[model samples]
Target: MSTINTSKRTIGVSFDESGRAHVLLWAPDAKQVELLLSGQDKTVSLTRGESGYWSVETRALQPGDLYYFELDGKKQLPDPASLSQPDDVHGASQALDINRFRWTDENWRHFPLKNYIIYEMHIGTFTPEGTFAAAEKKLDYLVDLGITAVEIMPVAQFPGGRNWGYDGVFPFCVQHSYGGAQGLQSFVNASHAKGLAVVLDVVFNHVGPEGNHLQEFGPYFTEKYHTPWGNAINFDDAWCDGVRRFFVENALMWFRDFHIDALRMDAVHAIKDFSPTHILGEIRQEVDLLIQQTGRKHYLIVELDLNDTRFINPVNKAGYGMDAQWIDEFHHALRVTSGQEKTGYYSDFNAVESLAKSYQDAYVYDGAFSEHRKKYFGMKTENPGEQFVVFSQNHDHVGNRMLGERTSQLVSFEMLKLLAGAVLVSPYLPMLFMGEEYGEKNPFQYFVSHIDPELAEAVRKGRKKEFEAFYMDGEAPDPLAEDTFERSKLQWGLIDQEPHKTLLQFYKELIAIRKMQQPLCVLNRREVSVEHNTEARVIVLRRQHKLQDVICLMNFSKEEQSVDVPVYASHWCKLLGSSDLRWNGLQDIPALVPGELALALPPESITLYSNKHE
Candidate 1:
């Protein structure tokens, strides 16, 4: 914190008496403007105006200094109120204080997004100095791969050093080449000192085309809503009450100034509010008044593709309370649980009764009747988020595909351990995408770079004619190629190797039986129980409570079938098998005979019994 020497006009930025850095610049058509410091020799003289604001102070500023704004004697700019932009797109503007670190988690907070099992990742491709102290040395491999939370993707200060942080533009700065804001508060204080819990993915719907700067600090944007990542934020236009308090005060400055516990946000259906209490009900009444003023446990989760159930309803039911949303009906029911329906939004998901009503009702076409936006989807989502963050792969569904494959390169290996035993025993919330627990074969494509050559040839001819109905030999990848973000990082030495360490020991024993089965991690759907067969696309859910249960069974079909067993049968044991007949019940268990239970799905296999009538 330095920057000193002054003389009126400091609209906001003043400090002198040997600690220099000052700005009151209001340029009325610059005849002069100077502040340059990079290559220091200290500079700062400005006092023009006939109503074109400009004034100064000097001590030649300090705190990580990187100033600019030369103009009218040849431009140099950046600090259109910058607090940090570190060298992303032509540098300048780096004066951060953020109470100078010194944090230690302070009895940390919020982590249980209904007993999360998340893992998202991407700090400049997770490592190789992707900083946040190189992902705090893999926080004990997500606490031994049992993860409680990690999310992270949009670090809010984007533009080279990496872009999958969804091109941020300083929303209270953090991504200064991945190690800013005291390196993400020392990577969320070393991931809450290793117990986990971080979340973050921000991007309040648009900003990025090289370190934006909120339309030069003001009208922040508004073309009366139009988003596919374009002009939608201005909350309702006209200085939108300070642009809706700059995105709910930058989501309460990441939970009371960066103590962040959860925020996910990014694309609340391109958030275009009409005010009258909306702005996601003023960010759900400012996240319930910052969760009772940081008394702890925070969360806001949104990602929404607009199937909105007023985002987890129940804010005394008036709605938009939001504590969760990303259910895309579990990726349109795991991309049609196997028929390979690859098209924009999986062309209304190929039915297994719409993946058994998106696993027994989470949203299987809430408002129904849609052949892809012809009509319905009038809203639905009764709950889904006991950490309901489901995913068989994420990084925007494998970097928006177009050759980014991976559901272990598009299914198989027993439907990728039957979509990880149906999103880790579904009841909501379960994610893992860093090499989908070691099935890593690579490819997360659709990279971006655009130093505008007509926006990089209109994003490479819109990613080669938008997949002309899924992979039509079009040739894509060249998002200003740095080998397309160095081929989406994360081949972490292929976890122990063989069949990728047997799908990383069946995803570390399905996260150790959902962390030693509290009724198999009860995110509760009345103890979860589902059973169906859409003719062949099998399904089973079970879960249960009071000591034991589990079930799981899934097929998503290719052929091998067999069903019918005294309805939801009983006396079972098997316990995990994606086949090599590998159910480690000390050698796969489907021969029970005592109370009748004989199974074999095989085709795209997945099994996990142990019921005993639950």
Candidate 2:
């Protein structure tokens, strides 16, 4: 390892005070490196400096100019830190002036993480146009649904037009099919204007197979560990310093340049690092510094499989200091209780008690023996409720299915409303997948365009193999087919239909209740209590904030049941009921209860009641 300058940005192209473009490339193994501009017939040889860094200051190539690096005058590749890939990942890298985009969100400020009601969306399937510009037109729709934040799937450049976005190889470049760099800037600006925070999902575990030129530049992957995708990203290895810088700078680029409110780091359990300073910890430290400098708030949320508190724990406690993480246990337990097949990881959870445990304790498997892995798994976390983002259906939960059937398609209408209540009324932060509010019937199947025939066939075979454990009888949908991606597109026209219209209104009311109700809005696990019955398949949760108290009663059984209620007040006022006729359910349930010992609950329904102070 050699000492390198940390003050200046040396891994990418930057414009200096003299308005000259300074190009930097880290190719320690290559003996020669040359810069090739798109239109110019001549190639400029870069001067190699210390620590295998090559650089050149040029005024000939201006912003928006396409350029490539010719290594050893043999292989010409796009810049690893390309800001714009206008011609897809395999083509030339466009020089983007990030400062050129005039933003109207100067006064916009991010709210607390606890207040976030996230709506996760994939840009391509979010609208018919499948671009950032098209998605911007739906900001008011999100606001009307009471969403405080929008978490977009990975925008990093992949091989072709359509993808779920996890296959992105170019970490810095926005997806060309999604209207590129300028498109994202405008979307973020529009999101901020609509008072919606933009949370960008970023993949740090593995890059996509095709058009991945990181290995060509340096030792970006390690042979020591292997991920499900392929070789794990080289972190805490021989030449890990440069690899660490590459990703850390990528995270900062989203915040500083694109004005992204937060980053949802994808599958962090695959990030193999055994260093003294963990990669996540380092990213958090740098983000904190950026927050202080910009006087704006930013968050780092992780999609982790391991139930480890160290990721969300503060750095002062020798933890990674991630602000929040997605809690899949909640979703698993909720689904299992909703009659999901006890296959794969779902076998680990069985009863309504698991859902109750998730509500009380953040992790249900906190140091418990796991039947899934056949070993003790997870650590207990005394973290606040807001530290966990709970969702009934996300991209992975839906798209990974053999048929990509959403909860809406699998469960009945009443059960859908119950699931919504179970998530929204909980103490944890709530998130909803795109088109889930209106019960869109279209499946969100996994789709990709790899451009390589061999790679495409491999993906098709791999998708079928993944469903082997579930004992799914039919053939899995072809991931490489164009119609697969087309079928996944959300049908906006469905919102105006019979059941869809009612479900959408129900979601609006539910979200409004979550926002306006004091006990529901305030995320405090300590102020919550859970009670359930295994036989009746009923769970009652009580959440309190100061003097406010709200109770959520959920019936997971197929038939109507009655459960004893502990009266803490004179009576319990009905806030919302899934059985209400307004939501297309039978209105047989009462609006108010007068200190009743037992209350009747409709089949597969959830009812909310706030205690009367009198």
On lDDT, the candidate that comes out on top is 2
Model 1: how far is 1 from its true place, Å? 18
TM-score of 1: 0.35
lDDT of 2 by residue, 244-281 (tens): 88888788888888999999999999999999989999
RMSD of 2: 1.9
**lDDT tens digits by residue: candidate 1, 1-614:** 11111112133344544556566655554677878787786667688754456777666667777777776657577765455776765577776555556888787655567787888888777766667787788889878878888888887766666577676666667777677777887788888878788888887777876657556545668887778867777877665755665566667766665677888887777777766677777776766765665577778888777666766686688777777767766776676677666566677776566766676677777787877778877555546447346676687777777778777876766677777877887777888877788778768776766455776787678777877665554566766688877777777888877777777788888888777766667677766767787878887776677757666677677777785445344466666677645532223435443354456666677777666544
Error of 2 at 599 (Å): 0.9
After aligning candidate 2 to the native by TM-score, how far in Å is the CA of 42 from where it should be?
Answer: 2.5
Clashes of each: 21, 0
lDDT against the true structure, each candidate = 0.70, 0.90
lDDT of 1 at 518: 68
Mark the regions of model 2 whose C-alpha exceeds 4 Å error after superposition: 1-10, 468-473
